[model samples]
Structures are given as structure tokens and as C-alpha cells.
Target: MTGKSQIADRIAARGASRSAAAAAVDAVLGEITSALAAGERVTLTGFGTFEAAGRAARTARNPRTGEALEVSATTVARFHPGATLRARVAGGSGEPLGAVPDLGSLQGLTASEPTPVETPVPAATSSVKAKSPGGATGKAAAAAKAKAKAKKADVKKRADAAKKADAKKRADAKKAQKKADAKKSSSKSKGKGKKK
Candidate 1:
């Protein structure tokens, strides 16, 4: 039946025996496995890298009895395709296998590229302000209050002064009227004695 050995012969080309091609493929696989076991990456030209990665410990459940189970942490193999392989799969360049695609004008576009932006920072703590505390706005309000108070005091003083002046004028006019009445009475008495 057709198997891996036949596939290898087809890849290796003319004059390569099935056993020899299989041995070559085994050698390459063995090398990759060994490197991964040693915590090293095995890179294949135009293919990809074979890496060892850790799987974290987790709790799993059994389906049969609904029982909880613990899955231990372990290392696993991971394969990543190379740039040429990715480009070919993506229908980039029409070039043959093992060749990098020419992405004219967009070559360097990548997720890792840096971009510039501005971030705002709050004002410093040392510059903290208690708004309207004994400042110009407060001073203006106090001055207005004091001016209103002074105006009331001045109005009261002027009213009291005018009352005192009016009382003094009434007293002087009453004294003058009493002296005129006294002079008229004395003249009438002198004229009556002469008639007798």
C-alpha cells in the first residue's frame, strides 16, 4: 500500500530508494524531536519552527461519572509556518515555493510597528488650590458688604442731626413770642394809670 516511504520518494526525486527516503525523513523527524526535548527550536528552511511549550495544570471532569480530575502541567510541541509559506498560502506573490513575497509599498507593515500619541497628565499636587478662599473674588464681596453698612450708618446720622436742628429752631421761636406778649401787657398798664 502507498505510505510515507512512497511519498518521500516522490519528494526526493529520481534514483532515491523507498527505504533511503524513509530513513532521511526519520532522521529529520528525530532531529526535530530531540531538539524540542532539549528545549530548543528546530527551524526548517521555508517551512517553520518546532517549539516546546508548557501546558498549565488544570482541573478536568470525567464524562462517565461526572467526577473531577486533575490534569498535570506538561510540555508540548508547537509548529509555526515560515514567512515564505505564509505568503504563498495568502496568495501574495505568484512566485514559486521557498520565496518571500514582494509586497510593493506595504512591505514593512506589521503589528509590532510603533505609533506616536499624546497622553494627558493631571496637574501637580503642589499646585492644589482652594477656590475662592481669601482671593480677589472674596475681597470684592467683603468690600461691597462694608460699603452697604457705611451707607446705612450715614443715613441714620443725617436723620438724627436734622431732628435736633428742628427742635432747636422751635424752642427759639417760642421764646421770642413770650417776650412780645410781656411788653404789650406793660404798656397797657401804664396807659390806664394816666387815664385815672
Candidate 2:
């Protein structure tokens, strides 16, 4: 949660006035932002590199309604941390870096071992029957078979309806095209008659 103000405070601790430190921090950050906006990479030796990366257009889905959507391609800002910063964050035995302060706030930041939890296993019961390839016997299987048949019939009906609709649309289009051609031909004959 270390922000720009905290960074300026850290800088001010090294003898500079608070306003001067804030201005310096603001100037540096503004330059970095400007460079990135102009598609230039800004690299701070032991900190990170900032640049604009192009993203390709893609199709995405709406999670709520399961509807598909298209996402347009664009350029986005990206950051890549330098080796020293990576090593420090990973608790490597490297020399201390100057940008990041050795504060108590960062203490105990090392990864801790996860505690193991005991899960109870369910007791087996003899009353539950194992299923065969044909499934449960009697009424349940009959009901399942009937439901499956009904679902298949409904799917077939919808498919047939869609096919009929497509056929009708094509037929209408063909008829309209024929009428246009006939009209064009009639106009051409009328033009010849007028010339005579």
C-alpha cells in the first residue's frame, strides 16, 4: 500500500524539504508516464521498465448471461521488474537496494509454510446399491428413458423448424430476384418500342 506520498516522505527524510521531495517525485513519475504514453520504454536501472504493449482483438463471453462479445485491439501499459527488485522481493541474499526502504512495514513479508488441515473420510454404507450399465431398475429407468426420448424429439422438432424457415427465406429471395429481372426485361422492351 506504499503510494507516491509515502515515497515523497521517504525522499524528504534525506534532508530535502517536503515540497521539494514531492515535486521531484511528481516530475519523475510524470516523465515516466509521458514516455509510456508516447510508446517509449522507461527503465529505472534496478527498479523496472515501463512500456506500452499491444493487445490483439479477441472474443470474450459475458459470465452472467453466457453471451459472447468482441473485444477490440488496443495498446496497454505494462511493467517488467528488474533483476534486483525481483531478488529483493523473493528474499534473495543480494545487496540492499536504495529505492525501496528497509522499513518494519515490510518485515515478516517472507512466505510462511501453509498449515495442513485434516479432512474426515465418509463411512461406507451397505444400503447403497452399485449401478450397472443399464442404470437403476424399474420406474426410475423408465422415467429417464421417457425424458431422454422427449428431449431428443424436441431437438429434432426445432431443427426441422429452422430448416423450413431457411427454405422459405431462400424461396422468397429467389422469387424477388426473378420479379426484378422480369421488370428489367420489360423496361428494355418498352425502350425499344419507343425508339421505333
Candidate 3:
């Protein structure tokens, strides 16, 4: 298992665990950090570039005093991980070293490596149809009447519910405002008595 050391350590380990591995990792990370701190960029093959970028100075207001203050320019280190790293992170082939095979075109392949065939099932046909009382017109008229009745019932139910909810809300708000006014008047009377 690879420990939490730098890339240098992993490379130095060479499939063997030793103190030299940690030292190598530390040295490489220290060098990279030093370069970045000094405003230098580092590039790794198949990996992205690392560099220190300068942030522009800006004027910011102090929240406490509402006074404008100048913020000084600063440099921040940033890492752009390489394509191979990104692909690996994103659970891809990470094939920057070689071209990846076209798996999309080879889709639907089985483990036995046999070509699959598409078979269509015939649509079902029903011999007995529903018998209406009179004809299609009678059935449609009956459906329309039922639909209009349902709509009217639903509208009435909804209107009643909304009216009830609005009344309850208004009552609650009035009660809350009355309680607040009473509290405020009580506090004011106490303050006046203390003054006297």
C-alpha cells in the first residue's frame, strides 16, 4: 500500500518499504514547495503544471467601521493535475501513454463473443371490445358529464380549504400582534414608573 508520502517517496520505494523512500518523498515535495514559493512553475509529464499565481491588489471595505482599505497583492500556489491524473480521478482509462480502445463501437458484446439478434414480438389484438349503452356519442356524453361534476366538486373543495386556511392565518396573525402590543405597553409602563 502506498502511504501518504510525496510522489518522490512512491517512486523511490520501487516496490520496497524503506526509510529512504520517505526521505526521497520529503526532498521532492520540499523542492517543489520552495520553487512555488519563489514564484516558479513545475511541470510533470502526464501530470498537470504547478505554479504560483499573483492575486491583484483590491480595495475592500471594513465591515465594522465602513472604512475603505487597500488589500495588498499576494501570490498563491496552484496545481493543475495532468490529463492522466484527471482521467484516473474521474475513473477513466488514464491512457495518456497510449490510445484507448473504442469500447462504444464494441458495445453489446457478450462474454461468449456471439453476435446478438433483435427479435420483435407481435402486438396484441383484442377481439371483444367494450359495449356502450347506445353508441360512441352516448359514452362520450356520459364521460363529459362525470368529468364536469368531478371538476366542480374539486373546485368547491379547494375553495373551501383555502378560505379556511386564510381565516386561520389572519386569526393567528392578529393574536400575535395583540400579544406583542401588550408586552410593549407593559415594558413602557415599567420604564415610566421607574422615572417617577
Candidate 4:
């Protein structure tokens, strides 16, 4: 339910001018949009990642008209929330919602009032550890740890595959260049040795 204006207001209440807060919000959104448009992923450690995802073309039907149509393949913006944001939404922080002070009161308060302290959200990695304590003895904890380990391993595997592919590409380019150079040298030698 929170919109950009609400976010801007929150930042403005935190001693920043309304214009500055608005500008900051706009700059962040602009950068995220630009990155997504450029097919790059933007990851905000404890917030989320924004990326462009490909959707394959497919046939679809209209429910009301029973008409068939073709959908074109395209890239769409996608967001995957990081653990801290997900945990906060799931009420895993153990802190009551009421504990978060009302920002409305701060609007009218004088400068003499203490500035609200913003509690830092735990990092996504720390959040996972918080969910699965070291001394815990349960199948759920063990499963969670195994799943996390598997996910980490999968990421590493993908990175290694990409690195290998890049190296292969470089090697192929070098091989092509060497072949072309040898061909040019042979052609020159043949012309030099010809009587005509």
C-alpha cells in the first residue's frame, strides 16, 4: 500500500528536504529501470533484485470470447525479494508491528524532538542463520540448511560454467586468428616464389 510519495515522506521526515527525498527516490527508480532495460540485474543486498526476464511466445485463448491469439516473446521486469524483506513481511522478526513508531506524529514535532532511529534490517545471509540456529535439532533445520547449501552450490556451478564458456570463446577466437595469419603468410610466400 506504500507508494513512492509515502516513501518520500518518510525520507523527508528523516531531516532531508522533501525535494531532495523525492529526487533521491526518483534517481534510484531511474537507475533500476535503466539497468533492467539494459538487461542487467540490480541487487540490493537486503531489499531485492530487479532483472529482466524473458517470456517465450505462446498461444493463448480469451476466456470470454473463446478467441485464440498469439503472444509474442518479450522481456519483462522481475523482482525477487531478499531474505530480510521477506522475513519482515512474514513477521519472522519477532517484533510487534506496533513497536514501529508512527511517522505521522513526527511531521508536527519540533526539531527539539529526537530523530527516529532506523533499525537496520539483518543481512539476507544472517537472516538465514537466524532461522536455522546452530544448536537446533530437527529435520526442518537440517532440511533448510541442506537446501541453502544446494542453492549456494548451484550458483557456484553456474558461475564456473560461465567462466569455462568465456574461456572457450577466447580460445576459439585465438585459434581462428592464428589460422587466418598462417593462411596469409602462405599466400605471400607462394606469390614471392612464383616466377611470374
Among these predictions, the greatest lDDT belongs to 4
Top candidate when judged by TM-score against the true structure = 4
lDDT string for model 3 (1-196, tens) is 1122322233332432334444444445667777787788999877789999999999999999999999999998899999878878799652233322442322332224321222222232122111331222344455668999999999999999999999999999999999999999999999999999
For candidate 2, what is the TM-score? Answer: 0.47
- Those runs of model 1 whose alpha carbons end farther than 4 Å from true positions after fitting are 1-3, 12-15, 90-196
In order, candidate lDDTs are 0.61, 0.66, 0.60, 0.68
**Candidate 3 stretches greater than 4 Å from native:** 1-14, 61-69, 92-196
Looking at model 2, the pairs that clash are none
Q: What is the lDDT of candidate 3?
A: 0.60
Clashes of each: 0, 0, 4, 0
Give the true-structure RMSD of model 4.
Answer: 19.9
Ranking by TM-score: 4, 2, 1, 3
TM-score of every model? 0.41, 0.47, 0.38, 0.47
Model 2 per-residue lDDT tens digits across residues 127-169: 2222321224334455668999999999999999999999999
Q: Per-residue lDDT tens digits of candidate 1, residues 54-89?
A: 999999999999999999999999999998788787
Task: Measure candidate 1: CA RMSD.
Answer: 35.3
User: What TM value does model 3 have?
Assistant: 0.38
